[model samples]
Target: GLLRIDHVGIAVADLDEAIDFYERTFGMRCVHRETNDEQQVREAMLAVGPEGGVVQLLAPTGPGSAIAKFLDRSGPGVQQVAYTVRDVTAAAAALRERGLRLLYDEPRRGTGGSLINFVHPKDAGGVLIELVQPAGA
Candidate 1:
């Protein structure tokens, strides 16, 4: 079964600037930050509303990265919506069975130590959707 909204991914030109804006404007403190080399992104995770909700600010590490391409095409903004799931692989299989397009053939390691997969935006009404299974789950 679906658990909850894990996080909302926001692509930013600068991770530091975005973090500062969130901290000053919304009083949100960044709980974690890391550069994911495999994903080619630097991200900061900010908890929100005390309900296990998180805002993930993402900045591209290089020109060829997905975030960088997105920024070039559409500018900085929401990139994806992630939902917590008990098992990401199972969820992805089910989605595939339902004829949904998945970006990855298998789950990949994502920020915050989660196994993640992406649903194609065309199949998700133009909004990128991510399924995440937390570390150790």
Candidate 2:
């Protein structure tokens, strides 16, 4: 079953500037930041609201990165909506059973140590949807 909204991912040209803007405008503190080499991007996670909602800011590391491509085409904006799930593999299987297209055949390690997979935008009504199984489960 779905747990809650894990985070809303935003693609930006500069992670630092995006972090600063969110901090200054919304008073949101960035709780964590890291560069994921496998994903080829730098990211910062900001806490929002009282119940563990997060805003994930992503900046591509190079022109080859997906975020960079997205920025090139879309000009930096909401990239994906992530939802917490008990088991990403299970959720993915279910989605596949329902004829939904997944971006990858298997889940991969994502930021914050979670296992994650993306639902194809075309199948998800033009919005990328991420299914995340948190670190422990």
Candidate 3:
């Protein structure tokens, strides 16, 4: 079934500013940063606590990025919740069998070397759910 909470995505207008806020205000540390050109977003991950779960700071990198659109529509805020799974494809299949609405018909590449699928917000009670399986997991 579910493995663990993968990450909590916080949409931001400025990645560096957000990172600094988390670091200085919450004593978190940036652990990873990656730019996804395909998604047109730059993401910086900060470990939250002793458990080391991360808060992903996302900034739109291009004019047409989905994050940019989201910010335009919703402003900077929490975006989506990601959960780790043992097998993303299998998880998607199970959810489909249960008649849950999925954003992706099949698993697709996600950040941090994971296979990911999204459950539609309408089906998930207004919360966008992301199923992620780490590469080689």
Assess every candidate by TM-score: 0.96, 0.96, 0.93
TM-score of 3: 0.93
lDDT of each: 0.93, 0.93, 0.89
lDDT pick, better of 2 and 3: 2
- lDDT ranking, best first: 2, 1, 3
RMSD of 1: 1.0
TM-score of 2: 0.96
Candidate 1 vs candidate 3: the lDDT winner is: 1
Off by over 4 Å in 1: none
Inter-residue clash pairs, candidate 3: none
Candidate 2 local Cα displacement, residue 103, angstroms:
1.2
Residue range 1-137, candidate 2, lDDT tens digits = 68999899999999999999999999898999999888899999998856668899999999999999999999999999999999999999999999999888889999879999999999989999999999998
Determine which window of 10 residues in candidate 1 has minimal summed lDDT: 45-54
Q: How well does candidate 3 score on lDDT at residue 24? A: 99
How far out, in Å, is residue 44 in model 3? 1.1
Residues 1-137, candidate 3, lDDT per residue (tens digit)?
88899998888999999999999999999998999887689999899887889888999998799789889989999888999999998998999889998878777777877788888878888777889999888
